[model samples]
Target: MNYKDLEFSTYPGFDEYILVKNLVDTPVKYKRGASYETIYNNEFNKWQDFFCQQYQVPAGKDVLLLHCCSWAKPYDFSIIINPIKQIADKYKNVHRVIMSNVGVVPYEFQMNETFCGYDFMNVDNEEKNVQEINHLYAKSLEERLFQYLESHIDRYKQVVLYSRPINMGNAPAVKNACERAGIPLIIEPNIDIYVKYRQKKYKQLDELFIEKECLDSLDKTLQLVGEKVGS
Candidate 1:
């Protein structure tokens, strides 16, 4: 996929260019709710075997995994990392961890150098232009993510997704990807809990009310996805 040939609202950045590359590298047909039971089962075992062989790790070693969007806010950072931290501390031989996001890298994982080069929030342009750029960036992320999961579904031992349920950000794209790959997606329920906790602690109705809107947005998203698949 020559990204230059495609039209984007704004000029493509380094991160967007990489996403295009990844998308082109892994091509797969995506259909919502596609049955992949047999393929997924077979690939899951194969991936484990392949990784063990390649890395010379014991086949029995467990792999713990978690993921968050690159553009997640500070609050979301806490939500996603806390659980992973607890589990990693408790376990041994848990070698592989994966975080998927476009741009911003998690501070804890900065040494891993897995984050993209651009910052999604720092697009300096007119408000309307910025919105368009963000939309294009998100679309690129979604398409690249779908291709990535299709190619590497078996590589994951567990997939935990942390995102605001309302925003299409990475959750819907990841959900669709997992469904197509016949993988079970573990969604952290921390977002709702976090919002409620804040509301109670701060006693700020107006601010909390805005945060609580995510719950409704989440429901609407689920309904929309359900309707799409059902149709």
Candidate 2:
């Protein structure tokens, strides 16, 4: 759906751009819920594979490992990696590792790179006797991930780390962990760009399809009307 077809608040950096339009129709929220497998499983996995193949991650003496749930809603993970391989190669001192929900790494795409053991990010705290999982909270997820990254940082000069937003306030933890370790930190920058594209693309949809800016009012209306709603 286009921007005009739905309603959303202006995103933080792009004050002129609406962050979302037909969110109810978008799979971002429910993509992680019970209906996720039926809706985004195949598509999300394809995206994971495509991105795993397309971008050439830089080989550096330092490694920036990422652990994310999904790149974003609708379940796409194709974020741009500027000179992906070049960056990796340039930083002879930096090696990049991306740990995700899927532990397997595409060993073929990487050339002359060090193979770091793939680590699993336990986002749901399902494992028993795992202290990290016990202490796991949205606020500390980043810190936990950072510690994980730090465990392997010694092999490289610097560690650049990133993760997806399964829970809230995760970026800060990743950022903080990077800071404490005195390593550089980078994040996937495609979501905002995609949102902008979506906003512009939907700027001129049919009036009837356009969502209004009043989410609260819409929620109330849906509650009264007994229709499914997006939160």
Candidate 3:
């Protein structure tokens, strides 16, 4: 059976994507001939750093960071995916981004033929001690977020993170990183919507974000940002 080849080609500069994907897909023992400790240490941290440096933007830009837990590999905007994106349109020189599970995912790269196939924001490699291992992964994610924020803080003028009040959307990681890096960040929906949504036991942010008021809050924040950035 001659399966028609998919119309896909890796970008010339992103040849590293294959190497990164393999690193994440590697097993707990790390089938590649490297020490388990070394692989575990570098897996999330080093790979995300690579992405940040590869696709970094010019200085003096505003970054509108959105969360897309529903569409892990977010290629386009939809009701559930990007209501906040429209709000960002008011602000000038604002870069639309999906601060995905793994690291920063710029909007333009989301549709890259190679990027559409996988979720760069998550790590699915299984391991023992479910809770403990996951916690370590969480720490790694936090470190990557910090590295990105620290590097971009000096470059980008302002960063506004629009997210639901849930861990699934990575609000906590950004908050922690911002605090440690002393990056002045603007948070959208700066209200206590969490306790209200506590009943849902959130594995994702789509539900809370669906509410009209939450989006209004995002719009309100961007309006202030527009005022400040003179957009």
Which candidate achieves the best lDDT against the true structure? 3
Task: List candidate 2 stretches off by more than 4 Å.
Answer: 1-60, 63-90, 99-143, 161-170, 180-231
Looking at candidate 1, the ten consecutive residues that score lowest on lDDT are: 14-23
Every model: Cα RMSD to truth: 15.4, 19.9, 8.6
Query: Model 1, range 1-231, lDDT digits (tens) per residue?
Result: 233442223114322111211212233322111122312333222322332332232343233233443233332234434343443333343322333323222223232112322123433455666555545545544554455444455554444454534454555665676676666665543565545545355432213323444334433333322222223
Candidate 3 residue-wise lDDT, 1-231, digit = tens: 111321334446653222223323344331221122432444434445555665465444565455553454444445566565566556666766665433455565554423344332234444554455445545655677677777766665556776745564356777787788787777766658545654675456465675677778777776666543452
Ranking by lDDT: 3, 1, 2
lDDT, each prediction: 0.38, 0.35, 0.54
Number of clashing pairs per prediction, in order: 0, 25, 1
Model 1, runs deviating above 4 Å: 1-64, 69-118, 194-231
Please, what is the TM-score per model?
A: 0.43, 0.31, 0.63
Model 1 root mean square deviation, Cα atoms: 15.4
Error in Å for residue 110 of model 1: 5.0
Name the 10 consecutive residues with the lowest summed lDDT in model 3.
30-39
**Which consecutive 10 residues in model 2 have the weakest lDDT in total?**
110-119
Which pairs in model 1 have colliding backbones? none
Q: Which of 1 and 2 is ahead in lDDT?
A: 1
Question: Which is superior by lDDT, 2 or 3?
Answer: 3
- Record all residue pairs in model 3 with backbone atoms less than 3 Å apart, i.e. clashing: 102-121
